[model samples]
Target: MTIKRVGILGAGKVGIVLAGLALKAGYEVRISGSGSVDKIDLTISTLVPGAIASENAEVVANSDIIILAIPLSRYKNIDPTLLKGKLVIDAMNYWWETDGIREEVLDPTLTSSEQVQNYFKDSTIVKTFNHMGYHNLQEEALPKGDPKRKALFVTGDNHAAVDEVTKFVDSMGFDQVVHYKLTDGIMTEPGSPLFGASLKYQELKQIIDNFDHTDFGRKISSTLN
Candidate 1:
């Protein structure tokens, strides 16, 4: 499916950067903060030129793809009915200091994205845009043919949704690496070796290939869990 409009649900660091990139790529973007539109209007216009500052519902209703950049704890605040049949990108990370400790993510039975999928069952959920730090996002996005282009990993249960998000990622100037399933995405979440790392395609692939055999992956897994 073609994605011309993007709706970002949080106007924080992640949301701001994503909106700016999308707008720069010529996609119509609307970003909403938890507060009223008036509160976010100036910030959206100033930070993300050509992007509209809207309410959450308006943003959700007007776009082809919706990005969840809000805190994981605020997932329940989103209306599933509004998101039904939409492609939703889960860009949230579980931080114990802020989100508090939760057994759902710690249970080992579900990856963080899986938990998000359960909450937004009607929406097509893809796990991405969470591993890299906001500071690296704009600086690291290189053109398609650039030898130094970095790759972003995308994982989801739906192949179509994953493919769609992958194209979107590439359009914003990063290579897209598609993993087959949501379970495989745990390797890219916070604390993993790839998390917050800014690496080129080959370097990132090396980390992913050695993720299981290396002590680095196991150490990060144990530390986060």
Candidate 2:
């Protein structure tokens, strides 16, 4: 399925950057923020020219793909029913300091994307675009044919949804898009070698194949804390 209209759930750095990239990739883009759309219009204009800014419900209803770019802590405030039948991309990371929580709420049981999928039960959720820094996301993407093209990892239970997101990622100048199983998301966790680190597709696959749960446990404990 082709993704034409893309919606972003926040007006923060991630949201703005994604919106700009989506627009650059020839998709109609819309964005919503907690504050008035007017307040963020200047930022949106400066970042993504011709992007539509509106209320959350309007943005969610009008787009084929919706991106949740807000903090994981604020997820509770969103109503999943609003995103029913839509492709939702989870781009959030658990920030304990910002959320004022000592431990990750989804730790020891589910990865952040899985937890987000559970929370947004009605939406087809895909875990992606969370591993890279905002700056890297905007500046590092290279076209598909480029020798040094960057890669992004995506995980989801739905094959169609994964395919759609893969196309979207590729259109944004990602050289390679690795579509892994939902369980593989744990390997791309915030502190893993796959996260925030630039690596080739084969190298990333090797890292995932040889991943050790005990080593992951230590990384999770150290990074999440």
lDDT of each: 0.85, 0.79
What is the C-alpha lDDT profile of model 2 across 37-83, one tens digit per residue?
89888888887888998889999888989999997888878887888
Off by over 4 Å in 2: 102-108, 212-225
Return the top candidate by TM-score: 1
lDDT of 1 by residue, 173-212 (tens): 8987777677667788777768899888778777777874
TM-score of each: 0.92, 0.90
Could you tell me which 10 consecutive residues in candidate 2 have the lowest summed lDDT?
212-221
Clashing residue pairs in all predictions, respectively, total 0, 0
Which candidate tops lDDT? Answer: 1
